[model samples]
Target: MRLALAQINPLVGDLAGNGERILAACRQAASRGADLVLTPELSLWGYPPRDLLLQPTRLTRQQEVLEAMVQELARTMPELALLVGIAEPKGGGQLPNLFNAVALVEAAGWRVVARKLLLPTYDVFDEQRYFLPGDAAAVLELERRGQRWRLGLTICEDLWVEEELQGHRLAGPDPVAALLPSRVDLLLNLSASPFGQAKVPLRHALARRAARRLNCPVVYVNQVGGNDELVFDGASFVVEACGELACQLACCTEDLKTWSPGRHPAPGPPADAVLPEPLEQLFRALVLGVRDYAGKCGFQRALLGLSGGIDSALVAVIATAALGAEQVRALLMPSPWSSSGATDDALALAGRLGLITHTLPITGLMAGFDTALTPALGQPPSGLTAENLQSRIRGTLLMAVANQQGRLLLSTGNKSELAVGYCTLYGDMNGGLAVIGDVYKTSVFTLAAWLDSPAALPCRRSLGLPERGELIGAAIRHKPPSAELRPDQRDTDSLPDYGELDPLLRALVEERRSQRELVAEGTDPELAERVSTLLRRAEFKRRQAPPVLKVSGHAFDSGWRMPIAAG
Candidate 1:
């Protein structure tokens, strides 16, 4: 049987739109001569529909969507069998009363074929909040042209046999192991896996393990495009029974690929499984995140404060790539303490990217703020508060430009500064979206170096950025990291050097390691304790910040939920 993977990007809670999207994919798959088609988890209402499922009439609305799909199927491809992901209601119940499920739709009609077993609660997924688990493994009997194929269907987290692979397990049944008794012809895992540095490799390892366990070709289809802070990378693939990759799909975009039962992919690395270099993967993910976030939120243009620091420089590059240079404008707000070289570098980089900029010097305004506040306070604002006033001045100017022009204001703060209490609440934090908030200071430097290298010339040219030599000129990239809020101010003055700090932040934030665990790993006890305290103390600041574009496993976005009042 010809099996088609319809990797689609669906908007959350747009039931009518999502249903149309699924129907279109199914029609396209039928046109491609595929007998069967599979879609991502929760394709009807999009994954993590969140409160949309809690609507009083959501179940009734879902039925309408299913009926619409059935009508579309009957009107178009009468013989094609399409499997769609949906939120199936379990009648009336207390608390959660739904299951993440798939409906097998044919010309006759549609019915719930399978319900997801494992409801993941960790790392951006809060499935348990809405769904009740399915106890039985789902095995579908697919019939086409007198041939019968037994295919097991699993949702996003169902195929994640963590105990066998990661040595630890989440609270769930082993979906892969449960399929052993069925002796199915093939296994299908519909996923909405988010992009992360380590996620791609880990997913492949798990796919190989499942294929080995089930002793069947495992087909994985995933959702694509940016959904809020999460970007689902649709790198779908087919793994053979012996752990050999048979076919692979594209990444970070909508893709459709097919695989036969006995077919093996052309030799060399698995096309979809060939992991990109860390920086490239991160850059692509951010670009997708930015483009989709802005597009979805109804913004055609973006504006940002360009400080000539490494953080803003990197953010400018990403924004330029995501939205064209013409659509992304920069504001150079130079305070009295801002360096001349910093202004020059900002202009140079903007020129290279063909970006438009308005240089608004805040030096005059800083004097005005100090003069006006002196009488009420009985003293001129000095020290940290004075430094932050400069930032607020720039932020207000940027927000005005963004508001007047109807553009998104992109925040440039990185993980290191935001991890601590180094950032001002409404000062530098003013923006519609935080482009690189998940990226660490050290990683920012590495990404800059990579973008300037000869390897990035193709990407630079493709994005219409100047590709003659270095894209992000050496002067801007090699300079010491600074906020330019005060004279001779460096990031090292407030926090540890990035080389030492990034590892510690990674342990504390992403790994969720305690101070004791960090000290056990040769980290200085005092330094670890200080970093931990800062990370916890800064939660309030992060709560007020813009929605951070997530690239890491644990971002200070929707996923990393922490308590502000509790220890």
Candidate 2:
């Protein structure tokens, strides 16, 4: 049997659009002589539809969309069958009325084919909150070329039977192990797994492990495109019985590829030309993330304060690459204490990127704030309050520009600052989206160096950025990171050096390390305690901060859930 794996990008709640996407894929598959087409998990409603799932008209709309798709497929490609991921309403009277489901639609009509067993609640998955798990495994009898074939079907989390993923245990029924009794010839897993650093290897390992366990070839199809903070990298692939990769699709984009039961894939590492280097992958993910977020949120222009710091510089480059340089506007909100080099560096980076820069000096605004607050406070605002005042002024000005120009304001704070209470609330944390808020400060420097490296020039030029030496330049890279709120202000004064700080942050935030674990790993006990304390204290601020673009194993928003007032 020939299978068409459809990796499509869909808008959440766009039922008609999503159905059309599936029908179109099926038509194309039929044109290419494929017997059946498989789409990503929740392809019809789009994955993680969030509160959209709770709408009263959801089931009605779903029925209407499915009927439309079946009719369209019957009219357009009568012979082709489509396996589409959909939300099946299991009826009301329970807290959850849905099952994460897939339906098989052909010329006759559509019926729920397979229901997901495991409802993952960890990290970005909140499936258990909205879905009731299926009690039994599914094995379908598919026919092609007048021959019978047995196929096992599973959803995203059902395939994640890994005992340990980065030491995080996902306790669930082993879908592959259960499928052994079903005696399926081929296994199909539909996923909407988002991108993370070194995540591909883990995903590949899981697929290989599953195929090895089942002793049958596995077909995996994942959703592609940026949906809010999550960027689904659809590098869907097929692994043969012996766990050798037979077929693979493209990553970070909409792709469709075909495979047959017995035919070996084109060999040679499943097209390395499209699978980018890790640095390049991160860059591309951020670019796609920004582009999709802006467009989806109905913004044509993106604006950010260019502080001449590394965070702002990196974000500017990404924004320029995502939206054209013509659409990305920069504001250099220099304060009284802002160094001349900082101003110069911001201008130089903006010039290199060909972005329109507006030099909005905040000196007058700073003095105005001081005068207005002096009477209320009985004295001039100084120290932390003074520093925050500067940030708030810049934030206000940036908001003004964003509002006037109708540009989405991009927040430039990195994960390190956000980890601790180093950022000013309603200040530097202001924006529509926090681009690198999930990226560690150490990783920020590493990415900057990678961007300047010769390997990045090709991807850079292709993205329409400067193809020459040092797109970020040396000054921005070498400069000590500062908020420039006061004289000679350095981030190190408040927080540890990024080299020392980032590891602890990752271990604590991403790895979920303990005080004992940190000490065992040779981390200073006091430093560990201090950093952990800061992380907890900053929860309220993070709750109020803009949504962060998740690139690491764990990010602040949906994944990192903590009670604000709890001990």
Candidate 3:
């Protein structure tokens, strides 16, 4: 039987939009003469419906939409068998829990034949808060093209059999392992997996091992698009029974794939060109994430303050790539101490990329703040207080534009700066979303190098635009990185060089190492102590920081929450 895996992107509460997307995929598959189609988990109401599931009426509305989708499928494509996911309500002292269920659609109607047996509750997942465990195995018996196929259905956490071998299986029985005894010919798993820096490799290995062990072809469909701060990279695939890859879907997109049981019965390297660098992959994902977030949040344009520095420059590149030049706007908000070269760079980059640029000097805004504070202090301040005032002025101007024009304000701050509490809280930190908040300073430099090189950069998905040579001009790369909040300032003045600081931060923040442990790993005792102190004191600041995409195993979210006095 010809099977189609629809790697789709769905909105959280757009029930009609989600159903329409599923139907469109089924129609496309049927046109290609495929007998069956599969979509991502929770395609009906979108994954992680969160509190939307709390509304009793919302679930009823979802049910109505599902019934309508079934009727449409029965009338329009009777020969195609479509498997889609939704929240199934259980009865009899079930505490009104929802199930990650798969509904089989055919000419007769729809039946939720399989339910997920596992619920994950680690890191970012809080499934235990909403869903109850399903005790029954998910096995579906269907006939397609006069062939009887017993296909096992698994949700995102259902096919997590690797845990059993590793002794980490805590949620439920291994869903894939349970299928081996059923003598199934094929297995299908649906997922809404979140994106992480090193998650793709682990995903491939998981699917390959499962397919090899079951000795049956497995189709994996993953959800794509940005939901809040979580970006889902949909690099879905079809693996053959013997672990050969038959087909692969596009990354960071909504893609469709068709595969047959016996044809090319093994998964292979992804058909699409591999992302050349971690930065390129990350860039593409970030651009897509921002684009989808703004679009889905009902905003058409985004505005950010351009400080003529690398962080804002990189953010502009991502914004232009994601939302296009016309949809993004940048303002050069310079203070008296702001360098001429910074403004030159900002205008030159904007001109080269064809983005709308504006200038808003903070001289008047600074005067206003100083006047308001002069009453109690009797004089304008100097040093860190004055520097922060400039930042706050720029931030206030950006927010004004965002409020007036209905644009989403994008904050331009990197993880390195955020880690050390180098940024001004209400000043530069005022924005709706943090773009490169997950990226380190060294990684930013690497990304700049790749964007300038002719070769494809690592971690970037396609920008869907013509290449403009190197993204970051050579001068920007060669210049020393600085926030420019103070006069004649360089980053190294307040902190260690990026080369020294990034590794230590990675070890301490991402690896969760103690000061002693970091020092034992060859980190200087002085630097280690300083880094630990900064990380601790910054807890209050991080708590108020905007939502950032989690691209690493350890992101600065609840996933990596540290007590204020942990040190």
Candidate 4:
């Protein structure tokens, strides 16, 4: 039997729209003569539908759409089978009253074929809040061409059972191990897994382990696109029983492919199976995140404050690539403290990227704010207050322009600044979407350097970026990082050097390590304590920041739920 993996992008809460998307993919799969079609987890309402699952009306609408899909399939392709993810209602007076489930739709009708056993509650996933676990493993037997095939069905977290591979395991039955007794011909996992650094390899390793254990080829399909803060990288693939890759789909984009279990291996890599370099993968993920976030939110254009620093430059490059240079607008808000060379660099970078830029000097705005607030403050704002005024002025201007143009405002702050309270609350942090808030300051430098290097030409061309030399320019990439809020200002003046700070922040934020642990590992005691204090103190500021496009395993988005009143 031939199986078609539909790596699709679904809009959350749009039940009718998502149903149409599924039908469209089914048509494409039917044209390729697929015996069965598999979509990503929660393909109906999209993954992490969150509070949308709580609405009774949407649940009713889901049932209507499923029935409509059944009728449409019966009228069109009467012989093909389709597996679609959905939230199945279980009316037994349970709190959640639903199961994260898959429905097998055929010409006759549809039925709940498999329910998810594992409900992940960690990080961005809150499945336990809305779904109850299925009690048993699901096995579907189908006859095609007078031959019966047994397939084991699993949802996103069901296949994530290996503790050694996943670092930690959820408290649930082993879905892969349970399938061993069924002697199934194939194993299928539908996932809505988000993109993280090097997560693609981890997913492949997990699927390979499942394939080896089940002694059957495993097919994995993932959701692609940015849903709020989460960006799903749909690098779907088929793994042979011997832990070898059979076929792979594209990353960070919608894709569909059909594969037969016993097809002979082709020479070299499988078609579309080669993964891009790590840096390229990251860049592509960011571009997709920005594009989908803006597009899904009804914004055709994006606007950002274009400082001459690395963070804004990197955001500019990503925004240009995501929405095309014409759709991305940059406003250069130069203050009295802003250097001429920095302005020059910003203009040059904009020219190279073919971005539309308007220089909005905030020197007058700063003076007006100083005069207006002098009475309330007893004197003109000075020192940190003065510095923040410049940022707030620029932020207000960016927001006004974005509001006037109906554009999505992209925030340009980095992870290091956000972690250390180096960012102002409503000033530099103003945006609808934080493009690189999860990226460390050092990673920002690396991304900028890569964008300028000759190695990025092919990917740049693919992303609609200029193929010419030095898109970011050496002057911008090599310059010392600064906010330009004060005279000769440098990020290092207020925070530790990024080279030393990023590793510590990674340990503390991502690994959940403590100050004592860092000191035990030979870190300076004072630095460790200071960094910890700053991180905790910045909780209030991060609480109000925009939805950050999550690239790392840990981000300051929905997953990081720290209290403002925490000690």
Candidate 5:
């Protein structure tokens, strides 16, 4: 059978819109003579519909949409069959009376063909709270040309059962193993997995393992687009049982491809099987995150404070690429402490990117704040208070511009600073989205350098970035990391050098390593203790920060739920 994998971008909670999107893909698949079409998990309502699943009206509307799809298919293409992911209501008195399900829609009608066996509760997922896990593996038998084919169906987390490969395993039924007795001809996994460092390779490894065990070719279809803080990279592919890639789709964008199981030789990776370089993948992911976040939130433009620091410079580049230079505006809020060289670099970088910039100096605003607060404080704000006052002034100005212009303010703080409470609350932390709050300061430098290098030309062109020369410019790329909130201030003055700090932060935040363990692993004893204390102390600030576009495995977003009052 010719199977078409629909890698689509769905808006969350838009049942009618998502249904239309699915029908469009079905039409494309039908034109290609595909007998069957597959969409990602929760394709109808998008992944992690969250509390939208709780509303009775949406549930009723879901049935209406599904029936409408059935009629449209019967009227248009009677011979084609499609698998659509949905939330199937289970009647009775159970609390979570719904199953994360897949409905097979043909000319006759639709039926729930497969229910997700694994309900992942970790990370950004909380499927267990809304879904009742299925008890058995699902096999859909199809008869085409008088020949019966048994196809195994698994949802996103069902195929993520390889503990050794994934380093950790969710405790549940092994969906892949359950399919062994059925002797299925093909294994299909419908997923909405988010993009993370090396996640594509891990998915490949899991699928390859399942293919070998089930002794059948595996087709993986994933949802693409940024939904809130999560960005899905639709690098879908088909893998042969012999552990060779048969076909691969595009990354960080919507795609559709059809492939028959035994069409090609199982010798080597296909031309499209080669993944993009790691940096390219990362860059594309961030761009997609920003684009979808702003677009979904009804923002036509984005605003950010460009202080000539590496963090803001990198954010400016990403915002320009995501929304176009015309849609991205930079506010250069310089203070008395701001250096002329730094301001010059910010302007130069903006020129290269063709970004609209407004230099709103805050020196006068700083003076006004001091005068207004001296009576209440009995003394003018000084030291750290003075530095933070500058940041708050710039943030207020940026917010006012964003409010007046109806633009989304993008926060430019890095993960390293957020981890240590180095960022000011309601100051630099103000934004609609944290574009790089999940990225380390060191990674910011790396990304900036890569943007300037020649290797990024193709990706740059794809994103509508300037491909001829350096986009970020060398002056900003090589500048020392600073906030420019105080005179002669450097990031290292408050925190450890990022070269030494990022590794520790990674271990503490991502790996969940203890302070004792860090010291045991040869980290400086006092440094580890200090970093750990700071990480804990920063929980309240992180809790109040903007929704960070999550790129790493562990981000200070919905997943990091540390108690604000805890020691």
Candidate 6:
């Protein structure tokens, strides 16, 4: 029996569009002479429908759409059976709780065989509030290739993580473990797993082990493309019953792979597919993520202040790559402390990239604020206070354009700045989405280097960027990182260099190491103490910060919730 895995991407809540995508994939799969095609978890409506599951009418609409999809599948491909993940209705007085259910449709009709037994409660998932746990395992029997095949079905979270602190004994058996007793011909697991910096290899290893332990061939299908704040890099593959990878699909793109039950698995690299360079992957992930988020959230264009510094320049480059040059408008909001080179660099970049940018000199606006506050605030604030005002004015001007043109404002601050409260609140912090808020300052330079290389590593979408060009070289590099808000400004003049700071931050914030522990790891005692202090002080700011892309094991979002008080 040939089973096709349609590893695909779907925009949340776009029922008609998602249906079209499913139809296209199923047609391609049918053309390959596959008996059955399986899509990722919730491929019909997208993953984690969140509050939409709470609305009764939304569920009704989803049900209607599913019936339509089944009718279309039955008519279009009578020989091919299709499996799709969707929200199934539970006939109870309960608040219309959601279920991760799958529909098995053939020439006859559709039947829901499996529903997710486990509901994830932690780490960006709040399934318990909306979903009711299922009670039974599913095994669908079908005739394929003149042989009777029994398929064990499971959803995304079913394969990972054991049940913890179960209150009732009637939660049924673990799905993967239960499949052993069912003795199915194949185990199909559909997932919408989000991407992290070094997580792809780990998933492949887990799938391989699961197939071997279950004593059955495992067909793993993962959702691809970007969903708001999340990018699912679909590197879906199959593992033979003997623990060898059979067929593999492309990463970060829509793809398919067909596998037969008896064939020996194809050998590849030790870690499944060869991963792209870190910078290339991150750049593609960010661009695709931003494009989808903006496009899905009902926005067409984006606007941001191009300070001509590394951060803003990178944002402009990425924005142009994401939404096209015409859709991206850059504003060079220079102040009294800004250098001529900074302005020149901004204009030069805008010209090179075919972006229309306005040189909005904020010097006049700064003078007005200074004059207005001089009497009441006593001769204008100095140091951090004055520097922050410049950022605020630039943010205000950018927001004005954003409001006028209905463009989403892009914020240009990296993780290093955000870590130590170096960014101004409501200033550079004003944005609907933060593109590179999770990226470290050092990694930013690395990405620029990748983009400037002759052999441009395969990126998802065309960037329209020069093959070999230094976006930020020694002049921008030699100078200490700065906000350029004050005279002779240097970022190190206030905080530690990013090289010294990022490690300390990882140790403290991500690794959850104490100040004493961080100091012992070759981190300066004074610097560690300072970083700890800044983290504590910046809690309020981060609390109000926009949602950042989660790329690391310990991304600073709701994932790494920290207490305000210092130990």
Highest-scoring model, lDDT? 5
> Over the stretch 333-355, how does candidate 4's per-residue lDDT look in tens digits?
88888999999998988998888
Residue-level lDDT of model 1, residues 25-48, one tens digit each, is 877888788899899998888876
Model 2 C-alpha lDDT per residue in residues 1-567, reported as the tens digit of each score = 789999998888888888888877887888889998999999988877988988969768989989988888788888888899988988769978898998998889999989999898888889878889888898889888988989899998888877766455567687778899878889999999999988887887888888888888999999988889998888888888887777778767788888888776565555532477899889888988898889878998999999899999999999999999999999998888999999999999999999998898888887888899999999989989999998998899899989998999999999999989789888999999999999989899999999999999889988899888787889999999888888988888888988999888888887788878999978888998899899999999999999899888899989989988987
Model 6 alpha-carbon miss at residue 506, Å: 1.7
Question: Among all windows of ten consecutive residues in candidate 1, which has the lowest summed lDDT?
Answer: 268-277
lDDT (tens digit, per residue) of candidate 3 on 81-109: 88888888875665547877888877787
* Candidate 1 TM-score, C-alpha based: 0.97
TM-score of each: 0.97, 0.97, 0.94, 0.99, 0.99, 0.92
**Each prediction's Cα lDDT score?**
0.85, 0.88, 0.81, 0.92, 0.92, 0.78
Task: List residue ranges in candidate 3 displaced over 4 A.
Answer: 92-96, 163-171, 265-277, 457-466, 563-567
- Rank by lDDT, highest first: 5, 4, 2, 1, 3, 6
Better of 1 and 3 by lDDT: 1
> Mind giving the per-residue lDDT tens digits that candidate 5 earns over 1-567?
899999999999999999999999999999999999999999999987999999989999999999999999999989999999999999888789999999999889999999999999998999889999998999999986567899999999999998899999999889999999999999999999999999999999999999999999999999999999999999999999988889899999999999887676656788778778999999999999999999988998999988887888899989998999999999998888889999998898899889989998887889998999999999999999998888888889989999999999999999999999999987999999999999998898899889889889888998898888887788887777788777788888888999999999999999998999988879999999889999999898998999999999999998888899985
How many steric overlaps are in each model, in order? 0, 0, 19, 0, 0, 0
RMSD for each model, in Å, please? 1.6, 1.5, 2.4, 1.0, 0.9, 3.5
Candidate 6: Cα lDDT at 390 = 89
Which residue pairs clash in candidate 6? none
Candidate 4 yields a Cα-based lDDT of 0.92
Q: Judged by TM-score relative to the true structure, which candidate is superior, 3 or 4?
A: 4
Off by over 4 Å in 5: none
